[model samples]
Structures are given as structure tokens and as C-alpha cells.
Target: MTKTIVITGTSRGIGFELVKLFAAEGHTVFALSRNDKPVKGLNLDNVFTFSCDLNKASEVSEVAASIKSQVESVDVLINNAGQFLKQEFKDTKMEDVKSVYETNVFSVFDLTHKLLPLMKESTHVVTISSMGGVQGSMKFPGLAAYSSSKAAVITLTELLAEEYKENGPSFNVLALGAVQTEMLEEAFPGLEAPISALDMAEYIKDFSENGQRFYNGKLLQVSSSTP
Candidate 1:
């Protein structure tokens, strides 16, 4: 059966790859992002793109209307949009922290809250997180704002899982390690990531469904190292 999957941050990276992966499988995919379209050379007719700034709550409402107009229910929801900043705590401004939370943490809540009615009983909510949020792990020095926002995501996922246990739709978090993508490159200039964005996207597509089937309120960390 063809599933309806909704993914955020489809402008690039893992989200872009996921749009292709799921659409090639003949699933109906809704790609949401600030950009008006998918990245160049990644366009697919199976994937419908919605342009909306997630940081703005009003835009999210408008997009929700657009989504509901087309699809009656969602099988999978991937909250993958995020903002990252590489700056020491002392150098990171409060505004940067607020911006990171706006995109990374709060936007997930806003969009998920609005889309809950469109999700069926078996819908899965997968939010991308980072290993930096893991306690006692390899906590990098310069990612205070980014890491904290990811931590908030993890906690929020847990809360949502429990909050909606009786209602419907499962919630899970994938706390990924550094993946080789533009976002990782921007944060750590020359360092190499053991996992590729394409590979992670493939894993996420399977895990989102499988995790929702067997697990709830769990945080699975994917990494090549302890971090």
C-alpha cells in the first residue's frame, strides 16, 4: 500500500534524500520547507513541496490548510528541519539560541500540533535529533545552542509519546551522530562524518515505520562512534 509521508526540511540534506527515497517507492510525500521547491535536480512529481517558514507560527497554519486540502490523513511525519550554530557559549548570542529553538524545537511542536488531526491512528512522528544531546557522550565545546535545542527535542518527543499514548500516533526520536552533509560541514569545517546523509535517510525511512510499530517514546541514537 502507498503511504502518505510528510517530511520537513526537504530543501536539502537527509530530508531531500528522503523525499526521493519515499517517492521512488510510490508513496505520496509532502515536503515542507522555507524554500519554494526541492533542491535542484531532486524534483519528483510524487513529492509535493510546500513553502513555509517554520519559524513563523502563522505560516505553519497556512501550510496546514494547504496540506489538509490535499490529504485526509498522514501516515508518517518527519520533523527534520533544524538550525545549527557553531560558537562557544561565551561567543553565542542569546538571539542565536532563540533562533535555534524557534526552528529546531518549537517549530516541531507547532507543526505537529497543527497536523495531529490529520494523522491517523498509526501515524508515526519522527523528529531528528543529535548525539550532542546525549548525556555523558562526546559533547563538543562549540555547540551549546545547537545541542541544547536538540536536547529539548528529545524531551519533547518523550512527552508527546506519553501525552498521546491513548489517542493515536507514535512519537520517536533519532539522535543521530555527525552525518556528512552541508550542515555538518558548516559546523565542523574539515572533519569527516562517518555516516552519509543518504544512508541516514534510508535508515530513517525504515525506522520511522518500524519504530512506530514496535516502540514508542524511545530515543535511538545512530552513530559510528560513541558520540
Candidate 2:
């Protein structure tokens, strides 16, 4: 069966790899990103690239409407778009924290809320989070804004899953560890991660396709390293 998967932040990293992986498997992928050029460059027939900034509520609504118009049903929604903030707690401004939340937290809610009508019981909503967000996980400094924002979505996933448990899509979150992506490089300069973007995407692709059967409303710690 060819699945219709909606992935955000498809310009690079795990989301970009996911677009290629799904398209190669003959799945229809709706790739949303600030810059569509990377996914567009591939020119895969199965992939549809949309230039979108999740932080913009209007853009999120418009993209959801566009997706609904194109696909009758969406099998998966991967909330992979996030804004990283690496300032110290004392130095982090309210505006900076809000900006991070705009992309990492609020946008996930906006896009998912709009597209949720097209989802079915069989559909899966996989949200990408960070290990820094996981409760009791090893914590790191200079990530107060980023980690707190991630935690918000983890709880939101649990709430949504329970709310829609009767006849709605499964909602789950993956609290990821260090992955060697540009985001990681930007966050922790010169630090190398054991997992690559493509490898993590592979795990997520498989999970998005089948993890719902075993889990829903659960936060899986997909990490091998500390914060």
C-alpha cells in the first residue's frame, strides 16, 4: 500500500532523508520546509515540495488545506520541524523562547490540528522531540528554551492520543538523542554523534509505518547518548 506521509522541515537533516526514503519506496510524501529547493532538486515524482515556515500560522493552515485538496487521506504526519535555541537561561530573552516555541511547539499544534480531520484510526502522528525534553533524562545547559519547548510537545502528544483514542489516529513522540545533523552541529559545535540523519530517518520511517500497533500516547526515548 502506498502511504501518504506529511513531513515538516524537509529542507535538510532527518526530514529531508525521510522524503527521499519514502519517495523511493513509492510512497506519496508532502514535504514542507522553509526552503523547498533541496527536496525539489531531487525531483522525485512521489514527493511534493511545499515552501512553508511552520512558525507562520497562516502558512500552516494554507499547507494543510493544500494537502487536504491533494490527498483524500493522510496515513502519517511527522512533525519534524523545529527551531533550535542555544543561549543560556540568563541570556535567553522571552522573545527568543517564544520564537523557539513558535516553531517547535505551536506550529506542530497548528499543522496537526488542521490536517487531523483527514486522519483515520489507522493513521499515525509521529512527533519528533529531543532527549533533553525527556523527564529525568540527563540535562544540558544552554538549552533551557529548546528543551522546555520539546517537553511541551511530548505532553501534548500524550494528551492528543488519549483524547482521540476512541476513533482517531495514534499520537506518539520520539525523544531523540544526538544525531549528526546540521542542527546538532549548530547546537554543539564540533561534537560528533553516533547516529546519522539517514539512519534515524530509517528508524522513524519504519516506526511511522508500524509503531502504532504496539504503542500510542507513549514517549519513546530514541537515544544512545546523553544531552
Candidate 3:
């Protein structure tokens, strides 16, 4: 059976990899991102791409409506669109914090809420969190806003899992340590030795198929070193 999946932040990074993996496996993948340009070098014909700035609640809503109109249900939704802004507390601007929260937290929540009705029982909702969301990562400097937003997402995932455990979609947060993505390049110039997006995508594909049975409602960390 071919499942219909929706993946945000599909222009690049882990989300893009997920879109490719699922589509390659014969699933209908709705790839959403701000950039509507077609994915290059992908041979899968089961993928559909949409362009929308996920930071905007209205835009997120529109995307949800569009998906609902096209597909009766989405078997999986990967909320992978997020922003990371690194600035010292003293130098951080309020607008930047708001923007981070809007992109990383509020927009995801709004889209999830809007799409909840389109998910049937056993549907999977995966929110891509960061290791920074964990308790011990406070030592990382200049991550206050981004980390806090991810923490909120963790909480939201937990609540959603608990509230809908019986009859609604399952929710879980994948707290990744580090992956070789554009975000990592922007965060730490010249940094190396992170997990590859393809590997991470494969891990997520397996998790999406079975992790809920063992790790649903909990934060599962994934790193290059973890096997």
C-alpha cells in the first residue's frame, strides 16, 4: 500500500532526504517548503512539491487546506521546518526571538492543529527537535531562543501523544544531535564530522515505521555515533 506523506522543510536537509526516501519507496510525498523549485536529481514520480513560507500562520493554514483538498488523509507528517539563530543574549533582538519562535514553534503547532483532522488513526506525526531541547544542553551558548522553541515542541509532542493516544495520530519528537545540513554550516563554519542527511533519513524512515511502538511520546535522540 502506498501511504500519503507530508513533509515540511523539504527544500533541503533531513526533511528533503525524508521526502526523497518516502517517495522512492512508493509513497506519495507532499514536499512543502518556501522554495517551490523542483528537486534536482530525484527520479521519483510520487512526489508533489509546494512552496509556502512556514513562518506565516496563514500560509501554513493554506498549505494544510491544500493538502486536505488533494488527499483525504496524510499517513505521516514530518514537521521539519525550523530556524536556528545564534546570538548572545545581550545582543539578541526581540524581533529575532519572535521570528525564531514563529518559525520553529508557532507555525508548526498551527499546521499540526489544522492538519489533525486529516489524519486517521495510526497516522504518525514526527517533529524534528534538537539535542539542545534536552536538559543538559544548556551549556551551549547563544542558543536560548532556538533551544527553548524546540523544548516547547517537545512538550507539544508529549501533550499531543497523551491526548490522542487512543484514537488519533501518534506523535513523537526526534532529537537529533547534529547532522551535516545547511543549518549546521551556518551555525559553525568549518565544522565537520556530523551525520549525513541520507543516513539520518534512513533512520527516520525506520523509526516512522516502528518507533512509535517503543518510543512514542518520548524524545529519541539520533546521532552519528548512535547505532
| Residue 84 lDDT in candidate 1 | 89
Best by lDDT: 2
Better of 2 and 3 by lDDT: 2
Q: What does candidate 3's lDDT look like per residue over 1-227, in tens digits? A: 88998888888888888887888789988888888575534756788777888887788888888888888898888888889899999999999999999988988788889998899887889999888887665346788898899889999999989999888688999988778888887776677745888888899887886676776688887655421
Q: Compare the candidates by TM-score and give the number of the best one.
A: 2
After superposing candidate 1, which stretches have Cα over 4 Å from the reference? 39-43
Q: Report the lDDT of model 1 for residue 77.
A: 95
Q: Give lDDT tens digits, candidate 2, residues 88-196.
A: 7888799989999999999999998999889999999999999999889888889999999999999999999999999979999999999999999988899999999
TM-score, one value per model: 0.96, 0.98, 0.93
Quick one: how many clashes does candidate 3 have? 0
Q: Per-prediction RMSD in angstroms? A: 1.4, 0.8, 2.1
Kindly report which residue pairs in candidate 1 clash with one another.
none
- TM-score preference between candidates 1 and 3, better one: 1
Candidate 3 whole-model C-alpha lDDT, 0 to 1: 0.83
